[model samples]
Every structure is written in C-alpha cells, then in structure tokens.
Target: MIERLENVVTFLDKYIAWMFVLVAVILFILLYLTYQCCLKYCARNLSKRDKPRHYRSSTLQYIRFTQVVKTPPRLSTDSHYQTIPLPNY
Candidate 1:
C-alpha cells in the first residue's frame, strides 16, 4: 500500500509539470498571434507613407472599424476633437 501511494504521488507530480508546460505553450502561441496582428495593422496603416491619399483611407477604415467618430464643433470657436460614444447597452 505504501509503494502504491508513492507511485500515485509521483505520477501526479509528473503530470502537473506537463500541465504547466502545456499552458505555457498555449500562452506563448496566443502572444505570438497578437504580435502578428499588431504588425499587420501597423504595416497596413504605414505602408503608404509616400502616398497621403492611401494612408488617409487606411486610417479612416481603422477609425470606422473602431467606432471612432470625428464630431464637428457646433460653435465656431469650439475645437475639433474625436469622440467615441459609449454604447447604451
């Protein structure tokens, strides 16, 4: 009975280490994917450095997707600023 209990404990310890390694690998993969997404976004917006028209369009698309609206000032003296309204829901 003592030998069997020791074997069970050893097995549990080994599998716990393996579980930790698996979780670490999954976290690394997710981090890498997020990094790739950031790189793609930056490339799209900045690839048209020489062309203002394309750059602006790309920026506008990003802004639209992010739900950022540029609200014009109601008064002549008011400043122009971007606004992201909160969702009612």
Candidate 2:
C-alpha cells in the first residue's frame, strides 16, 4: 500500500508540473499577442496621415522656427547684425 501511494504521489507531481508549464506557456502567448495588438493599434492611430491637418502644419512650423533659431546671424563689415531672411511657411 505504501509503494502504491508513492507511485501515485510521483505521478501527481509530474502531472502538476506539466500543468504549471502549460499555464505558463499559455500566459506568455496571451501577453505576446496583447503586446503585438497594442503596437499595431498605436502605429495605426499615430501615423502621420492620421494626425489633424492643423497639427501637422504646426509641427512643420515648429521645425522651421527651430532651424531659423539654430542658424548664426552673420556680422556685416560695419559690425552690425545682418537680418536673416526667414523662409515663408
């Protein structure tokens, strides 16, 4: 009877281990799918074309402004600040 009980216990241990492994695999798959879905959703919604026209125009304006700010003003022969011609957006 003791031997039979030991065999049963060993079987149960293996069965429980396999069950845990299966659960872990399933959970991992679910998590990966969820992450993929979130990435796709974000990419779709955050695409440049999906943005509002005003938002895109404002962003371009900001970029132009930054470029103008980055350029150093040239000094003329008279040591006066030369006016930089700003590009029309």
Best candidate, lDDT-wise? Answer: 2
lDDT of 2 by residue, 17-81 (tens): 99999999999999999999999988987876555456576877767766776788766777576
lDDT of 1 at 80: 66
Candidate 1 residue lDDT tens string, 1-89: 99999999999999999999999999999999999999999898776553445336676564553453344323434556534454232
**Residue range with the least summed lDDT across 10 consecutive positions in model 1:** 68-77
TM-score of the candidate numbered 1?
A: 0.51
Error of 2 at 1 (Å): 0.7
Give lDDT for model 1. Answer: 0.70
After the best TM-score superposition of candidate 1, give how far the Cα of residue 39 lies from its true spot, in angstroms: 0.5
> Any runs in candidate 2 off by more than 4 Å, and if so which?
48-50, 53-89
Q: Pick the candidate with the highest TM-score.
A: 2
Model 1 stretches astray by more than 4 angstroms:
47-89
